[model samples]
Structure formats: C-alpha cells, structure tokens
Target: MAGSFFRVACQDCENEQVVFGKAASEVNCAVCGTTIARPTGGDAEFTGSVVETVEAR
Candidate 1:
C-alpha cells in the first residue's frame, strides 16, 4: 500500500505545508522552521494539526 500525504498547519506560525506520511527525515515549517513531522520508522508523527489528507493518485 502507498502512504498518503497530509496538509499540516504549524502551531507557531500557522504555515501550511504538505508532508509525506512515511517521511524519512524531519519535516519543518517553511516560514518558521518549526518541527512539524518526524520519522517514526513507519508513518511519520505529526506535531502540528492536520488540515487534510491527500490521497495518492
């Protein structure tokens, strides 16, 4: 199965960004550089609020 993408809103800057569900590296906010997602060996752990889930097409 393929992993999905997520639209996350940063808590500090409220910047929205798309992140991979199985991200290998840490995902940061574009505006503030806040840690939004972290790799957990499988699905990434999100620190910010998830605005939407993007399905793979």
Candidate 2:
C-alpha cells in the first residue's frame, strides 16, 4: 500500500496526533508518552483510536 497519513488518538490521554502510515520507527503520544503506533513492513500498526485517514494531495 502507498504511504499516507493517519490521525490517531491516544487511548490513555485522548491526545490526537498525525502519523505517517509507513513510519520507520515507533510512534508515541506527545501528551501522555504512550505508544500509539508501531512500524511494520507496510502500514503502521496502531494501538490507539484511528480517527481518520489523511489523503495525499
């Protein structure tokens, strides 16, 4: 799949942030310092709530 952006909300703190779909590293929540997403071979594995997907323009 092509790389995109995702809006994820932290389940612990309800903090929202945008992350790369194909992130090469682990993504954490900025407010609560919780693990939000993990990098895989393709799309990032999300541990938080997926709010929406951002379309590339």
Q: How many backbone clashes does candidate 2 have?
A: 0
| Tens-digit per-residue lDDT, 1-57, candidate 2 | 567888999999999999998888999999989999998878789999989987653
Q: Candidate 1 — worst ten consecutive residues by lDDT sum? A: 48-57
Mark the regions of model 2 whose C-alpha exceeds 4 Å error after superposition: none
Best by TM-score: 1
Residue 49's lDDT within candidate 2 is: 90
Q: What is the TM-score of each candidate against the true structure?
A: 0.92, 0.88
Which 10-residue span in candidate 2 carries the lowest summed lDDT? 48-57
Look at candidate 2 and tell me the lDDT of residue 19: 93
Local distance difference test, candidate 1: 0.93
